[model samples]
Target chain A: MPAYRPPVIPASEITPRSVYLRRREFMGLMAGAGLALGVGDARAEAPATVPLKTVPGSYKVGEPLTSRDDVTTYNNYYEFGTDKADPSRHSGDFKPRPWTITVDGLVGKPQTFDVDKLIADLPVEERIYRMRCVEAWSMVIPWDGIPLKALLDKVEPQGSAKFVAFETVVRPKEMPGQSGYLQPMPWPYVEGLRLDEAMHPLTILAVGLYGETLPNQNGAPIRLVVPWKYGFKGIKSIVRISLVEKQPPNSWNSLQANEYGFYANVNPGVDHPRWSQATERRIGASGFFGSGRRPTLMFNGYADEVASLYAGMDIRANY
Target chain B: MAMARSPFVDRLTGWGIYVIGFVPAAASFWLGATGGLGADPVRAFEQTLGLWALRFLILTLAITPLRQLAGVNLLRFRRALGLLAFWYAAMHFTVYLTLDRGLIWSTIIPDIARRPFITLGFAALVLLVPLALTSNRLSIRHLGKNWRLLHRLVYVAVSLAGVHYLLATKVLDLTQVVHIGLVVLLLGYRLVRSLIPRPERRAA
Candidate 1:
């Protein structure tokens, strides 16, 4: 075998790294537009169970894990539909395999990785997290995935990148909720996190739930799981992660800013106008008449680990 | 073309309406007993009761329109329908208090006082009580013209309930707007009807 040699090329012919990155961003933009248009051949496919191998994760909640039945059936994946049961009922046709996530924007290495390949490379673990919803419902979930910082580290975010923006797959053809006469929200559900929040140890990119690859309704493929923030902050079925200079718009906040703030930390003191956040009805915790409810802890009981993230900021005002 | 019917047929039809009206409440009980109310049974049960109450209120309001526009005389069933609405609304509040709020008066009182939707809903329920109590013939005979005047409060009760429903939802989507739209249309019809001078009424 002869030693490989560099191809003879003029210095002017070489494309600058910035230009190449811009081209990738353009391609990413086109892919997003194509998804929004409901391009043909993006037909729905049934999601099958794919078990995952995992080790014990670091942030394990002592509370009883919510039943897998409840966790799987009850979901807020608006892509599938708005109702809790709609996701489970209508998501059978959604396809989660052959997925790819593009991590670009202000990063040194702008690369798109196949989701399966990324999952295989990551150190997957089982983390039991307490998820609190702004609607005042709580659940304890055992998620299987790697820390989000692990993925951000690979992309090598630039110093200018102050926030991380996430975008969900917008296939109206397969996802029933994305279509129809009355749309619940703007298409391609978007969420964002301050750079520090994205790099927090407690945050994870969950690949599986209860040892099996995520069911379509439960944000199959991969989803962000920020243990401290309200569950809406955990965007599902993410297709894009762009690190940018300014804070990105959040779906709920964009719809109603005063009600749903960008920093949706689970604070019991700050009451939602519609309902009190002081308490939450723990789903599937007890009998019919006895709705298992408990006092909501600040930061969803993860205060010890995450309170410093907002140390001096007025939580009520931020809320 | 109103069809004249015998007393037996009228009584049978009235009982039939009540039987049919009670079916939803019974079905809800069965679902709660069998764990068919889904992940959050309390919320499911509470919403189901509340929705049925609103539906029954709509039906009560529709009786007048049906009689005038469609030549359908459902007048005999209006009281039964109004009573059903009251019962369902009461049950909705009961579930919220006992199951949803765990009968905690401390939290429940504050919830009613602070949350505008809850306050509106509670006021609606309170307004419905007097209407529900005076729905019988004895009260109609005793109260005379005052009975009709008092029961006009249905408009206020339903309006409050409609706004309460709209406010309770997190997002004011098209469906929610349409839900309250029906009430607005029904109430608007009554206003329009009252404004138009009926030749027959003026001659009488």
Candidate 2:
């Protein structure tokens, strides 16, 4: 195997902590000036808000992070609702603080850890990554968390364990959609990865975004971040992690196996039966209509780091 | 028979229907112009326009049935209602092309070809073009007998629009189901009405 070389991220793409915090202030001053000059049209839009400080980590993408508003407001957490804004609107009353995640299955030691205690024990780092949704939308998000490997190491996997299955918390009362008869998909949204992918350096268990604790809408407390795969592969508000021998059934794949395959790697070559995967709309780049679409990258532009895992396998067939 | 109404009353009613037809479009425009459409304003705007188009199409289909079943003579405003539906549908298509697709023919062509939902929506829009063009009195007079035949295309367009709505939405909820059910009933009434022979008129 060849030695790994981290991609060189240019300094210009990075948003410094000070600049991010002051951006809201700067925009407010501009709005005030515009209003004073009788050009109040510009002030009609709401002022931007400061995001939580996400300290830079080793795995950083040289791209401007999406605005905090877009990141929070535009989400696809079906547990809350199917619409992009549903999570933000419906998840306000959700209680993410007293959370516990259980690790069982084929692990050497099965135990549960309180979310707060886990965060305290593991060192947190911020990773800016390009999150590509299967719906053909993309966002550059600054995520704060520990590597999945850090957590998996604590729950020593047995030799027979070939895959890692993840399960999200299911509180029907808090997650309205889950309780209702009109559930979008099966409850406790489950996802899985090969044992190697779980241990991959690119995969992290994200607890926060933009330097602050994860917003309820953005999968508060903890969520998985698999940079090379589609955003749905990163299950939110996880409660269970199990090591298994065979492949586990995922929420989407189980719902519509043909549409959403288990692998779910962001491969541009494989178009979703419903929509084209050739291009994606960047959430915050364009104006009200859209910023316009750019060609989708293979493996969501993380092919360099994760391509080796699928070297011999037929990605098209797997997808 | 009751006494005939005054011309002022008829004209006022006609104008009322016309103005009310545009209220949804006007409200959507106002919401979009302001920042009230929320995070993804363009999507909200496009969806609102599309929904209004479907509503107008449903209303337009109901006019003939209302007259047949309940003796409600809304036939006078059918042309205006059909035209309004066309207007909203045209605006919906324009937003999709210009704002959503950025008028990129390469992407647009593929989307129409590959996506069944887009294809159905585009087909509905195309079917409405001749109906809209022939809506004026001059074209109505020119086409004469053929005008009725040409306008029958509306049935096809409305059905396609129903399918388009079903395909576009992520979930098939009660609202969508009811809308489609209403469309089916309206179309079924037309079919049954046509199938049954009309009673011969008695000598006055």
Candidate 3:
């Protein structure tokens, strides 16, 4: 086999930190952006489970560890509660077993697969990506997961499948916030992706994070982990994926269409309604460790990869 | 005027002040945890602490007004509440200097220069320093009549603090309006009362 292929602009040319963040940014900017600073904490050190080799970085080769604060405090899993820290403490009850994802509508061989059997096909990889919350805070987490396209490929899509819809688990006993909304609720949490975005290499079907079985707060059992878009795009504890011809109504979009569109890519230039999107507070960058936060990036710094997908279209419209 | 307070009452009131102070802080943490602190909590936290500081300021301002209106004075409550107001204001400035700007002077300098609210906030905080310093009984006795004059600056400081809170929020929240109304009433009452001469019997 030939030696590792060089990127278009040689590897040395790019800022190592920025490139690292971009890869994870594709995963959803904050998941593992600045973390990997030090993985040798005096805590549980599980052997690396993912197939991907751990290169030279903060995390020990293949060993996975979690920041107690990240696991205990910062969480985007909204089922347990709306606060960032609430889900971490309260999402202990989300049951992930006996789960199945509906694969009907625009796909061939449409059927449900027990989540375990589905993930059994691909190996989970350890990736460090920047996970940026819309609130401007961020974290660089080392997550264990597989490419989303690998799963999408298993259940081939028909030509009409222009969009992919995802829905979350609906048990109120485990996930209490279902009743918060006054209107009649949709059984499962639903999120959709345009056909092309669904096929992107960086899209992940995450089963675990911090190299351990997922804590309910981080979306257990199975979840979609899209790195580039805002954290909201990556639906958690999902139960269904229905491919359709048009965009399905997304949770945030339905509530506030203009502010949260289907394509919620992280762009520092495009500001959110209540705050600036120009920069983010990168959670765990080195030197600044325990000191200060870092600025956010454009397209979550993945503009080079995903920007071409929306060449002539106006981002402001879809945004 | 009985000044006898049992130790239990003193202890109970101390705990009461602490509980009242903790309520806002606890609520802030809860709101932050739930994402109810809004999209940017550094700013939200700043606004919150500023509001608390102003509340303390109003509380200080209310001491006299409440005494005159109710015919019962609670001047003993003044120092504790004044210190609590200063504590919250300190927290507000800390959040502003640290989290919001990530502790970078570059980010803050421009903000202080361009934003009038920030400028006013800094000025208010600076002015509070002397008042807080002179808050002790030692300083009060040493300063004598000058103590009254020095403490009067609290009225100016509070007004600036209220302006700081209002201008910093960027939006008109009814809660803020209510706070401003209280400040107006407290200061207004004092002004109106001072203007009235002792009524001599007006006989023809």
TM-score of each: 0.89, 0.84, 0.62
What is the C-alpha lDDT profile of model 1 across A1-319, one tens digit per residue?
0111223435454335213322332342223221221123222344677899899887888788899889987888877766677688668767888999999999999989898999889889999999998889889999998898999999999999999999999886677666654456777899999999999999999999999898888898899999889999999999999999999999988887878999999998999877788999898888596869899999999899989888899888998
Pairs of residues clashing in candidate 2: A52-A210, A53-A211, A54-A211, A286-A291
| Candidate 3 CAPRI level | incorrect
Worst 10 residues of 3 chain A by lDDT: A29-38
Could you report the DockQ of all the candidates, in the order they appear?
0.20, 0.15, 0.08
Please write out the lDDT profile of model 3 over residues B80-124, one tens digit for every residue. Answer: 788878888888788767766667775567556655667777888
Quick one: best lDDT, which candidate? 1
Better of 1 and 3 by DockQ: 1
Segments in model 3 whose C-alpha atoms lie over 4 Å from true places: A1-69, A179-188, A284-291, B1-75, B78-83, B103-204
lDDT of 3 by residue, A1-319 (tens): 0111222434343444223322321332112211221122222222222333222222222223335444445666556544454465445555676678777778877878787776665677766666666766666667667777877777889998899888887765556444332112244667989989989876777777666655667777777877678888889887888889998878767655656788988877676654466555644232221224556777766677688888897887777
Looking at every candidate separately, what fraction of the true A–B Cα contacts under 8 Å does it contain? 0.47, 0.22, 0.03
* TM-score, model 2 to reference: 0.84
Question: By summed lDDT, which 10 consecutive residues of candidate 1 chain B come out lowest?
Answer: B170-179
Candidate 2 chain B weakest lDDT stretch, 10 residues:
B169-178
